[model samples]
Every structure is written in structure tokens, then in C-alpha cells.
Target: MSRQFRLPLHSPPSFAREHFAASPTNAQAIAAIDAWPRWGDGRLALIGAAGAGKTHLARDWALKANAVVVEAANPLAAPLDLAALRGRAVLVDDADRRAQGGHLDDETLFHLINMAGVDGGTLLLTGRLAPVAWDCAVPDLRSRLNALTAAIIDEPDDIVLEAVLRRAFAARAMTPAHDVYPYLLRRIPRSSLEAIAAVDLLDEAASAQGRAITRLLAGEVLAFEGDEGED
Candidate 1:
């Protein structure tokens, strides 16, 4: 006989301001995003590893600039009316991912770039690497992309990692003991992405068990690391 399974309902939780921990590792990127209107050039590129807050910063800038955010890879089902974007900003996230397969052809991105140039509007592109590293067929698009200012978020320091873990836990309304952090620092992968994943898994397990996060829960998650270690 087959047993029926019931999946838990998933509702997104709202994060409090206290849940966003800032650190020196991402301070420059955050500052640049905060000073959007005053930036010298209209075009900006944010480069960073996964889970380095690139998407968060991009969204923040888009909201402040009152702009539209588009994915760089796939073509929009309906093209955005150029008139609508005039004087407003545009943000493209995961742009490098599009570059791998020559997905961002000149026809798609060039018009947007030209429009921003003529309208004095801001255009922000985010990716894992600089524009030069991206493969493009159009000479003009390549040159134009390279001309934009590139900013990168380096790996977080130990202090930042600790703060990140604490904040992530707090965001889920789970309070992890102070001691659990030190244990995580020693055993978990150094990559912020991994750290965030571990925190998420621990939170999920704790929520299901109706208990606070602890080293024991953390260990169970860490034990599955097998060959895929942290970056």
C-alpha cells in the first residue's frame, strides 16, 4: 500500500531591517547602490560570486531609480515599449549567464544601451564576471559593455560571515545559540552561498522539529557535503 504524503504550505516570510546585516565586504557595493542618482555614468555593472547580495542590491537600485528589471538571458515575451523606459533606468541581472551561449545578441541589448545613452537614463548590469570575459559577436556591444564601470564584491570576512549567519537565522524567526556559530565557522564551506544554504536548511529542519537551531542540526546538514565543498 502507498502512503499519501502532505507537503507543508510555503508562504514567504517578511524580513525585518535588523535581519539585513551589513559588512565591510559589501560596503562599497552597497554605497554605490545607495548613491544611484548621483553616479557619474548612467551605466554600471556589479560583479560578484553567488549569494554576494548582487540581486538584492540590484533590486534596491531599481526600486530607487523607478526602473524596470529584466533578465539578460531570455527575450521578454513582450518587448518593453522604449518610450516607457525613457528617462527611467533599466537593470539586467545574471548577465554573465547569458554570455555563455551568445544569448545576449547585439539586437537585444544595443537598443537599450543606445536609448539610455540618449535619454540620460541609468542602466545597470550584473554578472559573475566583468564584461570583457563575456563572449559577444557585436564589436560595438562589446566595446560599450567594457566601457561601463565594473564593481565587485569580494568574499566576506569571518566577522561578516558570522553576522550573515545570525541575520539569516533571525530573518526566519529562529534564534540560533551563539555557540552554534563558532562550530559552523569551523566546519562549513567558506562560500557565502554555501553558508546561506546551510542556514536555510538548518532553519527548515528546526521549523519542522519545533526547536531552535543547534550544532546538532547544523552537523546533520554539514555531513551531506560529501565532495561538493565550499568555494
Candidate 2:
């Protein structure tokens, strides 16, 4: 029988500007954020897949711009009140969700876009889908989204993937031996989300077994992941 372990629950890794790993995949997106205030119409959209550094970049830009960060889960939530924001810059992560089905609400986001543009304040939105693809119902909202400058975080290459894997391990306070990184990199899919998830699972496995990360342990974890079982 296979043993099981309950993974500890924890908040996502806290974002910090210095901790972000930059590569060709994300340089353009980072550059766009760095060029803030100068962005045309004072707004921009960043599109990338999960774990593609969109949140990290958004958080860094928010810190630099003194912007308020809000998820697209529900724009009407307590903090999205325009009156409360005044003329502050705002960074909305997963803004694409709002486009699809009003996860952030078209009405509130429309107001936010206008507010962020007022008085040189800027708006930064991050999501997995491009603004052009947002299924907005409101005419004004559709036009506004269409007009915003857009950037993309491309799929990571080997170097960036390795960096991301290392960062994930570090976030859990586990330092994998030098060889462990290359080993996993060679075996796992070349995706930031996948790499992060693998690291998370490996960390929990190690924690449950009271073992340091090693070639054997990593192989065990990956082999278990490969088993689809009695499907």
C-alpha cells in the first residue's frame, strides 16, 4: 500500500521585486512596467500563463508606483471602491477573468481604468489571456480594453525554468542540492506552473519522510506523478 501525507497549507509565496527571476521570456513585460507613467494612455495589460511571473511583475510595479493590488475575483470587494482609491495607480491581477464573465465586473473596472488615467496615475492589469480576447459585454469597456497597450510573458526557456524551480524550492525554505535542479528540469515539462507544482509536491514528500532532497527522492516523486493508476 502507498503511504500518504497531508500537505501543510500555506499562503502563496510573497512577492518581492528582488526575488523575481527575469529572462527573455519576461523581459519585455518587465520593460513595459518599468516604462510606466510613460505608457500611452497610462495603462497596460500583461498576459501570461500561471506561474509565468505575472503576479511577481505586477507586485513589483505596484510597489514602485505605490499602487493598490486587487484580484479579479470580485472588483466590488471592499478595496476596489474608486472613491477610496482617489487618483492612485492600481494593479489588477488576473484581469482577464473580468473580461470573461465579470469576475471583477465590467462596470467597476471601467471606472478604475478611467481613474488610473487621471492625474498621471497608471493602471496595470495582468492575466493569462490577452485583452483582445476578453468577452466584455459593455461597449465602452470593450473599446477601453481594446485600446490598452498589451505585453506578454512568453513560455520560459531552460534557464528561466531552472531559475523558477530554484526559486520555488527557496520559497519553501528548502535548498535542493546543486544536481537536483538539473535533474528535475530534465524530467518535468518545460512549464513554470508545472515546475512550481512539482517542487511543492516534492517538498511535502520530503517533509513527510524526514529526508533531505536527493536524486532518489526526486525520482520517487516524479515516478509517482507519472502513475495514472486504475483509470
Candidate 3:
């Protein structure tokens, strides 16, 4: 059997406005978040490709609103204690994933939606696609999800990518040199998830080696056997 490698977990970063790199990609999504508590229908959905900053925005919004956030994909797994989420805005990340394994059925979601409506609480659902596109077997849940206000996150442009890289490094308390930025821009994958993974790997390498991040080190670490295929 192969050994399982466990990555180290670090403390959560202190999020700041500077860390959020606004771009045309997320302009509308950002605007909708700013206009909170006015989600008149009590339901809103954020649709985007993977690594498109959906989770980041959801976390940020949850912090700002002091709302009780729940991952709809792994919701309570038992009869939900509505009292726990009632009268408080809820943010459900990866809402589409729920339909994958029947983890979130029509009954559960309908109850949550009804609770939010009755309590005047907001419900924010995030997914890779609009509800209509999800493989939801329950007709009622599918219809309800499709009716929510939906917003899509555009892929980041070059400028936004650079800014995101810088912010991600800062979040790790790593001050990557300016020269390294251009190098990574040319070498790394455009997906935000890949970018974040690179930053994380760099952080671990730098810490293990007790040296500052440099181009040579980044290149070597990125080319290691298992990591070679990763951008």
C-alpha cells in the first residue's frame, strides 16, 4: 500500500480588502454581494467554473454579514436543526455537488428555503452551473433552484491573475519578489486553483528549506516527480 501524505494545515489568513482583486470577471458577482440584506426573494445563486473565486466570495460575504454559513454539499447529514440556521442568512457553497449523491434532496432544501423565507433570512447558493444545469432528480428542488437569481463568474484576465497571485502570496505571509511574478505568469496555469496550489507548494518548500523563495527554487519544486504534471 502506498503511504498517504498529509499536508500541513495553517491558520486562516486575515482577509483584507486588498486581497480581493476585482476584475470584469467578478464585477457583477461582487456588486450583488455588496447589495446584501436586500435579497428580496431570500434566494440567490452564484454560478461559476471551478477555482473562479466562488468560495472566497462566499466566505467574505459570510464574514461581512455575520451569517451562519453551511456547506450545502455536506449539510447536517441528519434532520437539520432549523433553529441553528433560522433567522440568519446562510451561505451554501458547492450547492450543485449536493445533487451528485442525493445528499441534498428536495425535502431538505425545500425546508431550508421555506425557513429562510419565513424568517426573512437570506440564502446564498453557489455552484459550478445554474440549477437548471445540475443533475437534480427532484423536480421541485430543480425548479426552485432554477428560479433563484443566478450570477456567473467570468474567468480572470491577465491583470486579475497577477493581482490574485500577489494576494495569495501575501495571505501566506510570503513576499514573492516582483521578478518571480512575471516568471510565474508565463509558467503557471491560468486556473486560480492551480495558482493557489503553486503558492502553497512554494510556501512549504520555503519553510522546509528555510530559504526565501527564488526562481530556481520554485522551478525545482515545481518539477519534482509527482508535481511535474501540475501547472
Candidate 4:
């Protein structure tokens, strides 16, 4: 007779405002977002690497301000109504992509920024890099974007990584020992998304083998991720 294994149900991770952990890595960025309406020039640039919670912070602020969120590439697809954005808070995510040569039209962005200024509306931008590093050709638009205050969210620290790992495990009803954090941290990439993916892979491996999560199991699981000799 074949043995049966009960598979765990998948649950989506929460991105609620209250659920966000405020650690040293992202405290400054969170503070900037919380200090909206009073921000000088009514513009802010929330910059961070992938999985550094820039989107989460932006979402939290948008929820509070009822902001209209749009991708940086939105203007390229069709005409963006600047009149509709008057007196409204606007969030433009992946702003760095606009600097990718041909992905975005600089004129559209320029007009939008100018209209926002005229309407006394707030603009929040999220990108991997600050405005200073953008490859924009329009001098006026470049100057305008650079004038906005920038809040940079740093890479994940040990505390954040541990919290991310714990949450990922908990979502799948897996109770990992405390040692699992430090053990996995030493081996996996220093990214929240990567840490979550590592947990997903490890949890699957453990369930398939009918074994408890341990340092040994983690090592075996990580080996499959090709994270060898890398941190």
C-alpha cells in the first residue's frame, strides 16, 4: 500500500499597512510616507531595491490619501488625463523604468508633473533608484523630479529577514525552530522575496519527505536553489 501525505493549503501573504514591520532598514522611508500633506513641495521619492517594501509603503500612503496609482509606463500606452489628477494624490511606481531609454515618454511625465504642481496636488514616486540617477533628457522634468525629497529604503537586515522567513512559514502552517533563521540567512540571498521563495521550496521538500524542518533539511533545500558559496 502507498503512503498518503496531506498537502498544506496555500495562503496569500498580507500587505496591509498595519502588518508592515518597521525596522531600521525601512524606518526612515516609513516615516517619510507617514509625514504626508506636510512634505515640502508636496512630492516624495520612495526609492528601494526589489522587495525592499517600496510598494508596500506607497500602498499604505495611497490608502490614507486615496491616491491614484499608475505605472511609469502608463502614459506610453494612451493619453493620461492630467485634468483628472488635479487636487489628487498620485503614485507612480517603477519610475526607474522610465529612464530605460524608450519605455516612457518624457513629455507626458513633464506635463503631468507640471499639472500636479498647478493643481496643488501631491505626487509620490517609487523606484529602484533616486531621481538624480534617472536617464531623462528633458531638463525641466529632470530638475522638477530632482527637487522632490527622496527616502531610500535600505536592504533587508537580519531582523527583517527573520521576520519575513517566519511569516512565510506561518502562512503554510510550518513551525520552524529559531535556528532556522540564522541558518537560512547565512545561505540565501539578502532579499525578502528570495527568503520567501526559499521557505516555499524548503516547505515543499520537507512535506514531500515527511520530515520536520531542521538545519539539515534547510541545507538540503538550499542546495537545490544553487545558492552554494553565496550569501
lDDT of each: 0.69, 0.78, 0.73, 0.77
Summarize candidate 4's per-residue lDDT along 2-48 as a digit string, tens digits.
11122233665566886676799999998898888887767788999
Candidate 3 lDDT over residue span 1-231, tens digit each: 111123333555444545677898889998887777777577778888876777788888888778776666774555456778788888877877874344466676776766665566788888998877876666777677667888778887667678877877887889976677876767676566667677888899999999888777777776634444433
User: Of the candidates shown, which would achieve the greatest lDDT relative to the real structure?
Assistant: 2
Candidate whose TM-score is highest = 4
Which regions of candidate 2 are displaced past 4 Å? Answer: 1-11, 99-103, 171-173, 224-231
lDDT of 1 at 173: 77
Give the higher-TM-score candidate: 1 or 4: 4
> Candidate 4, which ten residues in sequence have the lowest lDDT sum?
1-10
Give the TM-scores of the predictions, in the order they appear.
Answer: 0.78, 0.83, 0.78, 0.85
> By descending lDDT, how would the candidates be arranged?
2, 4, 3, 1
RMSD (Å) of each candidate, 1 decimal: 6.7, 4.8, 5.2, 6.4
Off by over 4 Å in 3: 1-9, 13-18, 75-78, 83-86, 99-103, 171-173, 206-212, 224-231
lDDT of 3 at 128: 91
Query: In model 1, which runs have C-alpha deviations exceeding 4 angstroms?
Result: 1-20, 74-77, 99-104, 207-212, 224-231
Residue-by-residue lDDT tens digits, candidate 1, 1-231? 111122232344223333444678878887777666666567778988866767767876776677788777665435556678777788888877764334355666776777664566888889988887876778888887877777777776677678777766766677887788887877665555566667777777787888767766666645634324422
132-153 per-residue lDDT for model 2 (tens digits): 7887778999998888889898
